[model samples]
Target: MTATALPRLCVVIPCFNEAANVAPMVARLDATLAGIAWEAIFVDDDSPDGTSVAVRAIAVQDSRIRCLKRIGRRGLASACIEGMLATSAPYLAVIDGDLQHDETLLPRMLEALEGGLAEIVIGSRNIEGGDKQGGLTAARQMISDTGAALANAALPMRVSDPMSGFFALPRDLLEEIAPRLTGTGFKILLDILLSAKRPLRSLEIPYSFRARVAGESKLDAAVLLEFAGLLADKALGGVVPLRFLSFAAVGAIGLLVHLAVLGLLHGLGGVGFNAAQWSATLIAMTVNFLLNNRITYRDRRLRGPALLRGLVLFYLVCGLGAAANIGIANLLLRDGVLAWGLAGAAGAALTVVWNYAVSATLVWRAK
Candidate 1:
């Protein structure tokens, strides 16, 4: 690739704390994309492990290597979106920063697009020639298989590996559907397939999923929850916001926490109704705050001093909601309008709307 020649294919790698893999990833791409004009863009989410620094060190020696360091923002889907938009390359591919995805498939994916075989090509492990045994552990494999099944049920087009992160598509098609993307979750490929206004022609290329040599795997139980949220967001056609759904789900869990604590204190310990209810409400509120930080506003998640400030602000913002909760439950209990369990649930339900509205605007509003 010459400095003056523009790349026909641009590979966007979204990274976080993958400093150890950046150099190896670049070298692999250089070796595989021999005669193709390709450039690599490493979009780092302000990784604490100095991922951006590593990319720059290589970029200084190779013009085809570049970096887009993002601070105060995170999420693989959004990172890939930003990196793809930053380039003028006609075709775009999204691969993991980890060495798991096959870099050699880039040329074939480009050929498929250029030959008009499909609008998008995915690197699939569920296909005949593909293998996931080398990379995913037993539990991780189970999660992937389950997620893909659920995703296929909701997707417009059937994909063997809807959860696969490795895929390539024309830049224009991406731009056409970019507005419809949720830009909030780990499964961007699923988001793309579901968001399209019309059915997209897609092909799957078989490849072995490689195990990680360095850095921790990001997959966890929380990721599955986020994946469900993405599907729910698409199903609703974006009429209801995704964050509100996540916030409401957390509120539902908080309600259970409230009841459990109330049952323990008032039912078993013989504590006064008023005192028990107040304690339960406070405890549930704290649980809701923590869960919301980790999931609902994850892209804008708080950390360090910011996390402390956010927690305090969350309590303050929900104070009115909590007050309403206590007042309503007391009224129902005093008037004997309902049983204690029913009364408590009624009050908690009222606060969901207030807390979601206020907390979103004040506590986790975009920084």
Candidate 2:
């Protein structure tokens, strides 16, 4: 296609470990979008299975197909943003690289954009003709249903399926709302809709969700946690980043762990109070680091040597935080602004805030 001959549709397929499905996905799109000019962008997260390598090989043969290999960062929403920004196509859309969504609906979805019938056309699996039984396992269907409920609760206009990984809309509108999008997790469709300046004129076309032909389904308990973080982000008007919220939530869990460990050691094990407190804090800090690394800094998760380095650094950070907590509490008490209990509470909150801020910037610094 010439520079002026940009395709009418740019399909962004955010993927991870989708090496086997890349070529088949393109062939399906080629058949589905027969008369329409379109391009498929496979945004890969540098999967260990060489997903980008497979996409790159195909891209060289077909100009309409392209690949964006992201390094370091690994969120689906961020990958979608990268793919959308790289293309010049007027009508932008997204689909799972796995053969789950009905690619045939893509034509009608674009039709809505071409005819100005709607600002967005989602390939929905919850409409009249569509249902979860088509391909979903009972557990997956339950997860999808629960996710939809959580997503619709925060959406400006209710949608039959807000957790859908497949959808399409205008590039201009996407660009307009891109900056406001958290771009953190698997719910890019929901993010785009929720971030819109005005309620979008949207329509959903019924389509049967298909079973995955290749690769593993990316959904899990972690995804639901991330979805909850997105809801919290929107509920707070984006005042706090989703990862920070995740960090804080994990910290709360750590607090409970600390108390439990302290109780077990001091009461049952007959350990000295100071010794039990120190041991409990250390264990809690380790738990906090692991949870934060897994959920809060998932895209920046460390491995092997990096993991070892991170753990050591985390210990130092928490140690400094503990010292700061004690110092601040003593200062608050001496200043006579707060009683011992109130001062300690403020200091503990300070420690949590300091650890969270420092951990993200220092322990798991993302580029």
Top TM-score model: 2
lDDT of 2 by residue, 1-367 (tens): 5455779999999889989988898889999999988998899888998999999998999989898887877888889888998898999989988888888899889988889999988888898998668778888788889988877777778789888878888999888899999888888888888889577888998889887778897676788888888888888999977777788899899999999999999999999999999999899988988888888888788889999899999999989998999999999999999999999999989998898889888999977
RMSD of each: 3.4, 1.6
Per-residue lDDT, model 2, residue 346, is 99
lDDT for 309 (candidate 2): 95
TM-score of every candidate relative to the true structure: 0.91, 0.95
Q: Output the lDDT of residue 322, model 1.
A: 75
TM-score of 2: 0.95
Alpha-carbon local distance difference test for all models: 0.91, 0.88
In model 1, where do residues sit more than 4 Å from their true spots?
Answer: 1-3, 303-308, 324-350
C-alpha positional error of residue 309 in candidate 1 after TM-score superposition, expressed in Å: 3.8
State which candidate has the highest lDDT: 1
